[model samples]
Target: MIAIKGVSTITVAGLFAEVGDLSNYRDPRQIIKLAGLNLQMNQSGYFKGQTTITKRGRRRLRSLLYQVARPLSIHNEGFKELHHYYKNRANNPLTGKQSYVALSRKLIKIFFVIGTRNCSFDETRMLRDIPQLKPLQEVA
Candidate 1:
C-alpha cells in the first residue's frame, strides 16, 4: 500500500512485493524513527537548545540500522562521499542528528530499492543517484 503511493516505479514496487514482509516492520517511517532517525527536542528553563532526537525509538532497530550506516560510510564510495559532504559543511554544521537524518533518508530510499528492485545494495549506484552531494573541498 505505502509502496504504491511512494515515488518508486512499478518495477521497483513489483520487486518489493516479491520480497514480502521484512520482519514485522509494517511502517517504514516508524522503522526509521525507531532507528533514532527522527527529529527531537530539548528545553531548559530559559534557554532552549536545538531540537534533538530522544533516542527513545527502538533500541535494537536503531542500532542495527546505524551499524549499517557506519560501515557503508566507510566502504561505500557514495556513503563516504555523503559523510565527507556532511562533515565539511562550514556555515551550517551537521550535528550527529543531522548526519543520521541524511543517512536515514538515504536508507529509506535504499530499503525501497532493495525491497522492490530485487537488487542488492550498491554503493556506487547510490552515489550516482545522489550527485548533489559534493565532496568537502575545505574545512572551516
Candidate 2:
C-alpha cells in the first residue's frame, strides 16, 4: 500500500491504505461492479420487473464506502452538494441503495485523485471539477 502523506482524515487514509494499489484495478467500472453497483434485471417475456444490484462482490468494501459517505454528506460541503445533486437532479431519483452506489463510485474517484497527487481532500476543488454539483450558499 502506498502511503499518502498529508491526508487530513486518518480514517479515510486508512481505508485507502487497505485499498492497496488502485492502479492495479485500471477500470473504475470494474470496481463499481465489484462493489455490487451494477444493476441486474429479472424479466419474463413481456413482463420485466425492476432492476437491482447483483450483490455478488466485495460486500466489505461497499459497506465501508457507504459508512464513509454518511458523515461526509453531513460535514463535507462537496459531498452535501453531491448528495443533493444525485437526489434532486437524477431522472430517476436514487433510493438509498442507488445513492450508496453513486457515492461509492465518487469515493473511488476521489481516492484515486488523492493517491495520485499525494494531497488532502479539497472540497472546493472537487466542486469545481464536478460542475454538475453546485455548492450551496450559506444562509446569513
Name the top TM-score candidate: 2
Q: Supply every candidate's count of residue pairs whose N, Cα or C atoms clash at under 3 angstroms.
A: 5, 0
RMSD of each: 8.9, 4.5
TM-score of predicted model 2? 0.70
For lDDT, the strongest prediction is: 2
Poorest stretch of ten by lDDT in candidate 2:
1-10
* Residues 1-140 of candidate 1: C-alpha lDDT, one tens digit per residue: 22322223543344244334555555566556655667766777987888776676566555545555666566656666777777676757686646756775577667745654567665555665544442432231
Local distance difference test values of all predictions, in order: 0.58, 0.66
Give TM-scores for every candidate, taking all chains together and pairing residue i with residue i: 0.59, 0.70
List where candidate 1 sits over 4 angstroms from the true fold: 1-27, 44-47, 95-101, 117-140
Q: Encode model 2's per-residue lDDT on 59-113: one tens digit a residue.
A: 7767777777776676766677777777787477776657756766777777776
